[model samples]
Target: MQRANAELVRSLGAVRVIDYTKEDFSASGHTYDVIVDTVGTAPFKRSRGSLGRGGRLLLVLATLWQMLLAPWESAVSGKKVVAGPASERVEDLRFLAKLAQEGSLKPVIDRRYTLEQIAEAHRYVETGRKRGSVVVMVSHG
Candidate 1:
């Protein structure tokens, strides 16, 4: 697990950052109120079991099957699946930015590459092993 990711999660009130590479969260016998699967590494079917009653699974990168099933599942089950693109609201964006500025929210920056090394950044992101955002340093001057 990336230290930045672990720290960021911890900073945002995470009791624990389960390293999925080391341990299987679903098999740990602990259910969660909300599970945010950003990488789409854990499929919705396997992860639904990890949610408590009336819990939510927020998928940032969902599979076609999961996307198709989300609406139907929400209508029929207590566990809700929230997937797809988020609404782009100016107020929401500014609120989040302000939180970051105030140190209330800290982004986990996995790696930084110069503008000259943008391709390297893309390659790293494509690997999908990045714990957080891969920053490309662009010089505006």
Candidate 2:
């Protein structure tokens, strides 16, 4: 996780950053009020067990399979798991823009490549060593 978005994590006020790749996240013995699984991988399927009592798991990239499956699991348990569509509306974009303008947040730019270098840029982004977002410089004349 640290390697995935180190700079963004640092600047975003994450006091303690854990590397999920190094160890099992559940073994940490910590509970969260809200679990936001952005990537929808790894322990996301097990998020219910890790949550504190009355905790909620918010799945951002919810798929049809996950949506149907998660609801069934939640119905039998006290902990609730809710999945939202991956679509982003204007309000969401506005909020993000506000955060940026307020200086509360900024996207970490791992690399900047010209539009002509898109293939190379994508290759670099796929390396899994990216510190943050790989930017493609696209210019319109």
User: Per-residue lDDT tens digits of candidate 1, residues 46-108?
Assistant: 787889999998998987788888988877878899887778999999999999899887777
lDDT of 2 by residue, 14-128 (tens): 7656677786666778877677776766334577667888788888778877787677767776777877565779998999899999987677787899999999998997776
Clash count for candidate 2 is 0
Model 1 worst lDDT run, 10 consecutive residues: 39-48
Highest-scoring model, lDDT? 1
TM-score of each candidate?
0.82, 0.72
Clashes of 1: 0
For candidate 2, list the clashing residue pairs, or say none.
none
Task: Give RMSD to native, each candidate.
Answer: 2.4, 3.2
- The regions of model 2 sitting more than 4 angstroms off are 1-8, 36-40, 58-64, 74-85
